[model samples]
Target: MRTVRYSNREELEGINSRPFLANHLRTEVAVHLHSNAEPSHNARGARVIVQPGRPADARLAQSVLCSMKELIHSVSVYADFTVAPAPHTGNKGENREAKMPSIIVETAFHTNPDDARALQDPVFRTASMKGVEKGYRLFSEGKDCVPLKAEPIDGIHLSAGGSQQVDVAFEGNPQYPIELVTTNVGCPPGWTCTDGRVRIETPDTKPSQLTLRCENAGSAPMFWNTQVVDDDGVKSPPVRHWVQCIRGPGGAVASPGVPAGVEAATAG
Candidate 1:
């Protein structure tokens, strides 16, 4: 999986303008699409071409093209490139031998408002990561996994006040149940843990220390965990092993976190 950002015509030229074509045929590549970065006349959208091989060329090309079509259809944001077999040999030797599947992703248009906004969002950065993951999954596994959605957390508005808390959530195949635990052996004077909950008072005082752990108790388990940091430059120990337990059919378990609506909000 590789991410190549193409912001201008010069960069695109560095790629397309390469003197040698045979040596540059990459098995996988994604060029970030941009319009304004290059002169309008210079921009040629994006193109993905599959070359035919001996025995399985036709079948592989068809499968790849179909998958690309599905990916374009599934997402509302990006446009799909016209996919076809390579036409010219260019400077390279006869364009025979199965050329690896190639895709060029055009990401931005200078004139489009939506494109302008997309460039500024962290979500857009994440989209690139997802694209790379999808490309590898498709090329190797012949299937693409559905991308996970990231929840929006307003970091600026979350206030710790004088208390500290950590939350955990689980969602996946129901067969698995997740267990979360936290241990506080060196907590400050007013900090305590009871019934799987840790409470901290005197936000101004530095904690002697704290530790957290998580584990799953099911056939198939998945784990997810994170940490909390305060205003001071102190690093809190990460909640360890927040494992997901695959419960039996028709089983359920609880998630960690302060009850919903209990979080205090601060002005941004």
Candidate 2:
């Protein structure tokens, strides 16, 4: 069981390199993990994709999705919590021209509040990976699953060239070396306002707080990906909290824009 990373910085930078490296290494199968989204923010649940006319790819896709189906829980009011009826067919740059079987797993929709909350839970991360392991013990598995909840922060409006202290709080028996990251989505094009990564110095299991700085150089929104990582290197699912950076005058950097409904602390 080998792991492959297509890009760093939580952004899609080296996508085409996936199939290239897989073919170069002569890997037997390829699996891509991803979260889904849509403009409506109503879509939820997990699904898989494969290249058309490939039997091996189809089987691998089904095998993994079946396992994920059992582990992930749906938050959709419409009862859409299972994998798609069949593997979706596509010729994406990451899957096309691969000499071996390949499949892409859409874990869940980050656009939905319930699904997004589940994605950040450590228990959900562990269980989802276990499902993938079972799927692979047999190709891999998907996440609206949660055992830990990170308080949600949104509607955070900031001014260009202004900075704010973001306090991220969550509930769980967290292990040491927790890592908070920012995903590729949400930030404006060519903007580098995200803090990128921050480490929790304390190892408290309850009422933990992670404070970091987020400065805006452009007018756009940002989503911070928060996760708990044990010393063993296992990572919890990411909790993506949103912030809005605005470009205008009269906005103060020191005046915090802490939104309502979130339990957060301000760094003095």
Candidate 3:
């Protein structure tokens, strides 16, 4: 849910630090998304890589893979799930180093023309992300559960060290008495989020709403994740809400145009 990097240009934090930070933040499941490639340019499919010999990691991988396979044009889903060893030597990175379950999702092969075109389409990109969300829900909750839905609040403009109370509405007429909580995904360094309870004045007659407070101490654009949890412990898919901060002095928005680090911050 929370992204390690907001832009492609971000490189201040190296790969070795990702797993360490994820562990420090105590993330539930770490998912690294990437596009695949091959020399033959004939290979095509969505693949998930997990740490070797970890059942929990494999379970997470399969759950995500099952949902993603339905929406993507993959020749193979890699049902078995690929188990990857530690990257290089001294310090393990990403999947291998995380304390929690982790997986790498190779959505498609850019090397293949058909897959490359699909990845470029906006419709396809949206659908693919939906699959990942559903897959995550399946893992967190269960297959038979009705996944909760909330639209993402992205690209909010705020001042550095400023706070905002965001009102998020549920997608459908969900049942009452659901609690909203921050997901395992984390916030950027120096940021803080205070979660709120869901309130519905009219029950099923209208959508439920949750008003949460977010404070950004740094001048950067970042996102955090939250999900709806029912009384039975079933969780809805995670929703990533983003905020862009402006410089306090000049009131100029800090652009995500340059590389920067987005480490974990406080959340409740």
TM-score for each predicted model, relative to the true structure: 0.30, 0.44, 0.43
Worst 10-residue lDDT window, candidate 1: 170-179
**What does candidate 1 score in Cα RMSD to the true structure?**
17.0
Ranking by TM-score: 2, 3, 1
lDDT leaderboard ranking: 2, 3, 1
Clashing pairs in 1: 33-106, 33-107, 33-108, 175-246, 175-247, 176-245, 176-246, 176-247, 177-245, 214-241
lDDT of 2 by residue, 1-268 (tens): 8988754534444666888899999987878888888888778777788888888788777766655654443222323455675688887766776789888887778998877876787766655665555565454222222234466644456554444565666654333566555443454555443244456656653444443333433455666666655433444567766667676543222222233233222222
Best by lDDT: 2
lDDT of 2 at 198: 52
Candidate 1 per-residue lDDT over residues 13-53, each given as its tens digit: 55554323533665343222323344443343222333333
Q: Judging by lDDT, tell me the better candidate of 2 and 3.
A: 2
What overall lDDT goes with each candidate model? 0.33, 0.58, 0.56
Q: List candidate 1 stretches off by more than 4 Å.
A: 1-15, 18-98, 145-268
